[model samples]
Target: MTRTVFFISDSTGITAETLGSSLLSQFEQQKFEHVIVPYVDSIEKAQAAVEKIDRVAKESGEQPIIFDTLVNADIRAVIATSSGFIIDVLAHFLGQLETALGQKPSSTVGRVKNADRDARYKNRIDAVNFALDNDDGARINRYDQAQVILIGVSRSGKTPTCLYLALQTGVFVANYPLTEEDLEERRLPRPLAEYRDRLYGLTIEPERLSAIRSERRPNSPYASLRRCEDEVRDAEALFSRFGIPYIDTTHASVEEIATRILVETGLRGQRSQ
Candidate 1:
């Protein structure tokens, strides 16, 4: 049986969902249907949410679970009347923090308004734009501005990894696709020579590479197993010859690849807010 789980917040509901999901993951045998109700800043909206929860509880014959991040007392009071198990995320910790710090907390809704937060948000946006602008070796001249440069054969998870690094961690990530000619040459591209210290390589198993390529260009020489094997072999050789660190991306997700790069390069401190 599946239970209903509601993530309620006065803003995007991201905080409620993130924390709630982590907590729910502990129950491995149960299934949950999630409902995110965001921007519940008003009493009317909170009442509506409570009514919805109550209706779900009656139909499912089980008390629904609610993860609430509401900071306003009036709005929170309205939601408290719902026929569900309420977990007030902020209220549980805010008082403890206030006592520890010897100060009253600012019970604000949504993101905290501050100049530093605004700057960090802007940096994230700028990083995303930089990743897009420099994707797939489009802007080699801009390598000096990049925090990290990813190099790999086509569809070796370079583009997605670069974008993930930029969006999630605000790292200026750029990717360069190593073509057949570059592989045959057995050397780093001229543009990447000056930035060798920032270069990270990604390789994939030939079978997986061929499979991915065949989907893009079926029945073509470029998608052949022989071609895939040759490219990956030479790419790995090139990385070794140049003493460049690399990772096999055959089974790694974009998030894993980006995280590995950050950890390997000791750039975890560069992660964004």
Candidate 2:
């Protein structure tokens, strides 16, 4: 079934969207259409959001689900009048938090983005730069600085996973693309051989890899299914020979892949407030 979801907030709506996605993922039986309504900080903007949501509700014959991080009582009240299942995400836990902490929340609007002002933000930025610098074996000399090195065949999801780990956890990541020569040798590359402890492999199903690569180089040998199969098979064999742990990325989200790697490696992330 298809349902509409609205993520409304006074600022970027990132928190609302992230929380809504996490919650909605639990309901695997239904498919969702997501709409983000950001910068809804005023009564006027809130009414506009309500209008848009009501239109979807009317056309679909179902009330849209709203996940809101709106803090202004006046604006929130405007949203409450809308034809939707409103979930005040902050109010759900703020009262208990206030009582436990023996203080009231400042009810600050757009405070989530304040993460950019702290040391954690700089850490994430540095890590992202490192990922870009060392991507696809471009700067093998920097491998010694990386906490994790992802090795995989082209288009096997090495690049995005590395960036996700860096952006989310500040983990310095480097990636190497296993080329035909490296795969044929059935061993790690000379530069990578010394970093076996930090090595992690990623593999994807041949059919999917072929389709992905085909988008970039259609009808070329690089995108052929046979080539993909050969690359994946040989890559796995190399990982096995080196006793390097790996994961299949074909069906996993970046978050799932990155979380698993962090858990397995016991790498440190996110400094405490």
Candidate 3:
């Protein structure tokens, strides 16, 4: 069944927007049709959206679910007629908050009063949002979608790189591991081969690689210095031979590595220019 969802909110409209985007991203998986109507800021816009939903429902003979977050009960009532599911998310939560605190929250921006502090918080939130929305596997077709890809062997810093890119640059990043099997064959996985044009690899000195691996898998052949050196050599050789660019992840911060990769790969300048 094709499902339609209408989103309504105020005050935290930005929050609502992100949630709507995430939900809409799943439409392909869920096989549901959806629409996001933000800033039900006025009775008129909400009414119009409601009317549209009504018209579509009658014509299609299917009731569409409406996800409403109207803080004001009056606005909620105006849209309630056509919405199959009217949810007042903010009110419900805030009501509980009021009950706990024994008073309503002041609408003042007191919690984020300092300009610099507010900006920092905003930036951090944006980075987290970018990470959740821009994971690595999703970056495959979307070179434009990635802030950067953290390419490395297991425990070679892919996850940290991805998290740093997200938290610092607000760029969506995804990481993929280069397995022993892939190194054995001296080729990227078949799936990654399709996106080789956008591929970036990460490497480290074999000794350092072995040290890090040992921490994760002590006394195992997988983390042996010899095995680590072989894999590192094989991976780097394969990357260089194929002309696929890579970075040495040793002794670099996430910011430094990500910036260098973007610059060297011409991914960042190309996008901006």
Say which candidate scores most in lDDT.
2
Alpha-carbon TM-score of each model against the true structure: 0.83, 0.89, 0.48
Q: Which is the winner by lDDT between candidate 1 and candidate 2?
A: 2
Q: Which regions of candidate 1 are displaced past 4 Å?
A: 1-3, 25-32, 55-63, 205-207, 268-273
Location of the lowest summed lDDT over 10 successive residues in candidate 3: 264-273
Query: Could you arrange the candidates by TM-score from highest to lowest?
Result: 2, 1, 3
Off by over 4 Å in 3: 1-147, 267-273
Summed over model 2, clashes come to: 0
Q: Note the residue pairs that clash in candidate 2.
A: none
Question: Which of candidates 1 and 3 reaches a greater lDDT?
Answer: 1
What pairs collide in candidate 1?
A: none
Q: TM-score for candidate 1, please give it.
A: 0.83
lDDT of each: 0.90, 0.91, 0.67
Candidate 3 per-residue C-alpha lDDT over 103-171 given as tens digits, one digit per residue, 9 for 90 to 100: 976533213347765666566566666555544444455545554555567767777766765565445
Model 2 lDDT per residue over 29-59, tens place: 9999999999997789999998999999999
Q: How many residue pairs clash in each candidate?
A: 0, 0, 1
